[model samples]
Target chain A: MAVLEVRGLEVRYPRASAPALRGIDLSLDRERLVVVGANGSGKTTLVRTVLGLVRPSAGWVRFDGRDVRTISGETGVSTNLAEVYRLISLPVRDLVEIVARLKGGDPAELEARLREFELGEVLGRRLFELSTGEQKIVGDLFAVSFGPRLVLLDEPFDNVDFSRRRRFVRLIRELRADLLLNTHELELIAQLDGWRLALMFEGRFLGPFAAADLDRLYLTRGTRADALAVMETSLGTFSVTRDSGDRPVKSATSLNALVESLA
Target chain B: MNLWRPYTKAMLANGSLWFWAFAFMAFWLAVGAFVESSGVGPGRSAVVAYTTSWYAVIVLLSLSMLAVAIANSLTYGSSALAYAFRFSRLTPEGYFGSIVGGSAVMGAALSFVLLGATAGMFGGRFRLLLLPADPAGLLAVSLLGGVFFMALAVTMILLVINYLGLKSTNFTGFLPLVLSITLGNAQIYLALPSWFVYGSPFNDLASLLYQGYAGTPATVELGAASVALTWEYLVVGILVWTAVLGASSLVLLRQIRSRQLEEGRQI
Candidate 1:
């Protein structure tokens, strides 16, 4: 049974010229799903909709067959979205304790887990006092510290140092919860082998292909439609379109190349 | 999470807030005492009336500052940390309750400081001239007034952001504090009708505080004539306003979209 389902989801912000999310359909259970997208591609919007933070203009989102809004308290969904780091006035320790208590987890246990990342010294420091990378690490640590049923991390590697990013990827791989991570870092696809991959462009999703198939995929200029390219993966073939003019496309194997072609 | 302890600790940690809550009122009280000691008034009764009135205004302003601070905590603090509440077992009601509880405790402690200071300062010469007639009543009025102002400020600020489509700026926060202080002291500056004066929660709260401190029914000095405010009128006004504002705040809380708050569209 699907633990999470988002069907025909469309979110249109007030006075927004274009919808933030359009016809997003997803189903996740225990599989690790990685969504790759650029900025303003609606990855955060999709995550917020799933978390019941943003109401959709169309369709519905459900967790365990119940509406997401009604079952949010029971779902144990956690996220590392930047909004979680907005409480700059609070010490990292207070924020962690508050989150742990709210999640019904022991604060001491969560703190002990965060200490594993060498975040112990910064625990007493206010969030605003830390570097951006440190703030992101704190958010990521709390998102996974409680062993939630599902974890949704948006751009978890952004601003993080390469060494910390490597450690974070290792930590994420060890988690038992279903994971839905979205980022523009293409190299992560090879590191997180066996994970499912989806390419998002302007509020739409393109694929759920195997992460391992990324190296085998190819992109070529689209002739039949207004698209960035026609991508061929292990599963099937599809055209990737954007809101703007397309760039010259070549045989693309790396995700970065594909993104550049789309760009 | 233990909301009370954390909220209290967070509030107490703010040194500037402490300065405003204590130092501002202490400064005024010192000036009042100096005036009283200098024998500046016409008679003992006149001096006592002036001192009590001064104390009431100073306390009201102090409470206003505290109330605005609580509202800010509810607005900006919640806006910043809303994601924590959304993903946790803690309900919106629980979070709201904790903030209110923590603020009420702070307000009560401050009231005691004001009361203790007033009694200690005035007890020497005036024989409890400026001390509250009923310390318990004054505390009760402080708690009620503190919560009411917080609710009013929160509702007004949220309405401006959510309905008026205004961004939560420093002006939005300041508007409520200004409006509250003006309305709270309107009777002192303006000679409004008896009904208009007593019907307003701000005036009613002021009257109750005055009554608690002066040991007499609060009299609205309307230029030439005066109207004594009754206990029934003041209590009813406060209760009704608190209930309405509190319910409105809860309704607005339910309608809040975390995305808007995350986007910095709300406080």
Candidate 2:
């Protein structure tokens, strides 16, 4: 049975000419799914919509076959988005305790998990006082500490150090929950082998292929008159663009390089 | 999880809130008491009237400040209410109940402080005004009044966020204080009709506070002539307002759908 489902999801900001997400359809059961996209490509918006933070302009989201709005708190949905910590002035310990109590998890166990991550020193410090890397680490730990049925991580490795990033990869591999992670780092795909991959560009999704095939994927100038960039994947070729221009074809494997070439 | 414990601790830990809640008002109250004591004779009607008026203002100001605090806690970016609603087992009604209950407790505690300060400063000089005629009634009114203001503030904040799409605290933050001073206490300054005075929640709250403190009908100065509001009229007005505001707050809490709050737009 599918644990989470989103159908025809579309989100538009007030006064914005373009939609942030358009016709986004997804279904996740027990498999780990990774969405790779550039900044402003609707990855964060999708995560937030799934968490019920943003209302969809069209369609609906459901968890365990029920509408997301009908369910109360502690529905086993967790995310590592640092925006959740913005403007929160409480100490990390208080935050952990609050979350643990709210989710019906053991506080002592959460504290132990913090210590395991070498984050015991942050217990006394307020969330806003921590560095960006530290905040990401705390957010990541909180998302996984509780026994969540579904976990969503948006750019979890953005500001983290190399050693902590390696540790987080191990943590992701060890997680028992179904995962939906979005990132632009192509190198992470090889590490997370066997996971499903989707490429997001301009509010649409492409290529639900194996993460191992990321090395074979490359972006080049499109042959079609209206297409801006064309993604050649092992599954098929997909193109989504509004601009029509003649530019040098730049073959790139990573999202950053592809975005740079597009720019 | 016990929500009150953490909520109360957070409220108590706010230094600026304490300054506004107790220290700032207490300073003005002490000064008023000292000046009034030196000028007026003991057991004078003028003293009772002055004390009642000052007490009403203090109650209004303190509760308004509390309303703003409660509003911020519920709607600000990364607010506890938002986080709990998203991740915890907390329902809208549960969160609303905890906030109102917490505000009532704080309101009752503050009433004691105000009453204690008034009695200590004036009791030495005026033996007749040693204490309120009904101390328990004053406490009850304070608690109920706190709940009313909190409900009103929360409903208004949520309404603005939902309809106007405005989530900035700078825009809607001081709404309670502004409303309390102008509309909430309009009866004190303007000559309102008998029906208006009896129907308006703000007027009712002011009347209740005045009557509770002085143990008599509250006299509303309407230009040259004044109207005395009876206890029956004030009680009915407050209860009706409380019920209406409470229901409105619950409805608005369940309807809040602003995406800006989660995006960190509140300043």
Candidate 3:
């Protein structure tokens, strides 16, 4: 069963001229899905909407065949490694316990996980007192304790150190939940196998592109045909159809490309 | 998940609670000592005044809430961790119970400290002050009464500000402390209204200290204490206010949840 399904999702901030997200359709099972986009592409909004942190303007989000908004959509291990919960003034242990209770995970399990990350010694320390990297590690550990059925991480590698990034990614990948990880770094998802990748731009799902093009998309951004030609020439192309109106449409290369071909 | 343990742990871990608790105790002790050495605090007839002296303790309880608010701003205030905590099955009731209950418990402990220090300062003369009020009423008013007032007043004050959309951790956290001190100080210089004085727990606590013990209450110069409301009326006020204060905490939880969610943050 699909653990998370979002269709025709639209989100508009109050008094904003443009929507943060337009009509975005997505589905995920237990598999890890990577959502990549430039800043302000609605990656965070999509994750927030799925977690019910932000109410959507239109469309529905279903989790494990249940409505996401109505189902008390707990963010099981949903945390952003890069940001500060600046208001958290308690010790790390208390924070972890809070997350545990929220997402239905065992506090004991969280403690054990913290020890694994060498964060056990610092658990007694206040969150605000910790270094940024230490705080990031603690936040990630709290999420791990949450262990909800669907985990959404926004910018999961933000404040983490270089050495710990890979390990953090590996640990999340090991969790037994459907993961919708929004990250700017494509290399972070390179280690996973059979992972579905998608691009969100101005709140629209632009691709479920093969994971093969994950890193190269940035190098080939332009008009549709130009981008595709560069992608094909540099890597390779698969004849794929995209959803248009009621039926899939096979769009031919653009006029600029056709003229280049005749030349 | 042991429900009480979280509240207990949080209360225990907060130095702010202990700081305010001990600070009030020391300050009260010092004042009592100063008054005795300088020959001032209570007159021979001022025995009742000593028993009712809980202003600092009340402020401490209110300050404790501010401390928690500030602390929470770091975690729940940030929104992401709040999102995790909210859906993770952490009941709003439990969270609130821990924060407010912890502060109340700390206040109760300080009351004991105040009682001990004040009696000692009077060279055992102050000990007999409780002989007039019913023992049960004295104990109830001294211990749980302060706890109830502190919890209700502080929680309501913080929640009202919270409802006003104040999000800055420093602002939300410290404003209560300032308000507690300000409102408390206001009564000192100002001839506060009778009903306002009566409703003001800090002003009326000494009077209400005898919750159920019936007697011809002697009038003391509790200038700010509400004199308009008779003692009988004050008794009903305590119970009603205590219950409402507790109930308001739940409302606070809802307000926080809805308001924070509106901002795409979790409470």
Estimate the TM-score of every prediction: 0.86, 0.86, 0.72
Top of the candidates by lDDT: 2
Residue pairs clashing, model 2 = none
| Weakest lDDT window of 10 consecutive positions for candidate 2 chain B | B74-83
* Per-residue C-alpha lDDT of model 2 across residues A152-263, encoded as one tens digit per residue: 9988898888888889889889989999999877777789977998888777777676777665554444445444345543234445343223322123455545645554
Q: Encode model 3's per-residue lDDT on B86-136: one tens digit a residue.
A: 454544565555555654555455555544555455445444433333544
- What stretches of model 1 exceed 4 Å from their correct place? A13-17, A70-72, A85-88, A223-263, B28-40, B74-85, B116-129, B166-169, B189-192, B221-227, B259-267
lDDT of each: 0.71, 0.74, 0.55
Question: Candidate 1, residues B1-267: lDDT per residue as tens digits?
Answer: 337787777676777767897787878787777664675466765555656665666666776787677665444444334455556665556666666676677777777788777667765556544556788898888888777867777787667555654455446667655755687557666776778766888778777877887788777776688878888888988889988988897777655545344444444
Off by over 4 Å in 3: A8-19, A55-60, A65-70, A73-77, A80-90, A94-98, A101-104, A215-263, B1-3, B32-43, B50-86, B122-139, B142-163, B167-204, B210-233, B255-267
Residue B4 error, candidate 2, Å: 2.5
Models sorted by DockQ, best on top: 1, 2, 3
Position B256, candidate 1: lDDT: 54
Q: In candidate 3, how many clashes are counted?
A: 13
Alpha carbon deviation, residue B61, candidate 3 (Å): 6.9
Q: Which candidate do you rate higher for lDDT, 1 or 3?
A: 1
For all candidates listed, what's the TM-score of chain B alone?
Answer: 0.83, 0.83, 0.62
Model 2's TM-score against the true structure: 0.86
